[model samples]
Target: MISAVAYGWKVTSNAHKNHETEGFKQRAEDVDQKAVNIHVANIICSSIQPLQNRAVLNCIEEKVGPDEKFPWAKFRIEKGFGALEKLLKDHAGRYATGDEVSMADAFLAPQIDAGIKRFNVDMVKFPNFNLENFLCI
Candidate 1:
């Protein structure tokens, strides 16, 4: 996953010198924002999303039980969300990295939506990670 994300970044970086037009403001020129974007993306891609993926859920259901999958996925998602909230606490504006929509925001929106709609995540627990306005419905 890391390699894939890195490769995409490299390709995007080379192909588009200015990512602002691509909706990835951090990938444009801001180093710190880029770091935040990468970290946030990694958190969701590496740890959070995989927990609910079909393969992992199947494994858990086979090894543990069908009932355990939701709890396991929910726990990991909340934990990852908490980390993201802390990581972006000082940097986030209206979006994940800043006021403008960036790469992190793009990556996060879907995950947040999935957590709510698919996983039944209780957004009320994550007060700071509220992305209601950022979601496109």
Candidate 2:
């Protein structure tokens, strides 16, 4: 019988490459509104990343009680879900096959799932945040 470790897959793999392109990147020149949103969201997400990370760290520190720890700065987890969620969403949902399936979608999904479990989020308000979006990439 296989022994259970902690939740979620921890295995590292070069999954993104399967998308058949390196990450999108370019040097800055002009203020494009679309690019600006991407830049802003990343900044926003990074700013609060500390809380969840600290919560993870707190798990190591054993400072807060379990009640606080599980949902510790749960909003941060939610924010991560939101950002990763947007990344998966930007695609037109063409993907629907293969072992790993769409890499970005595969990558974002577990993170989103963890956010849901960790934060107890009510995703209904965000109409765009649908299961179809979740299923597709």
Question: Top TM-score: which candidate number?
Answer: 1
For this target, which candidate reaches the highest lDDT against the unseen true structure?
1
Candidate 1 root-mean-square deviation in Å = 3.7
Clashes of each: 0, 0
Model 2: per-residue lDDT, tens digit, 61-101? 48767666655566556665565445434532333111223
Q: How many backbone clashes does candidate 2 have?
A: 0
User: What is the C-alpha local distance difference test score of candidate 2?
Assistant: 0.41
TM-score of each: 0.80, 0.43
Residue range 94-131, candidate 1, lDDT tens digits: 77777776667656776788888878988777665656
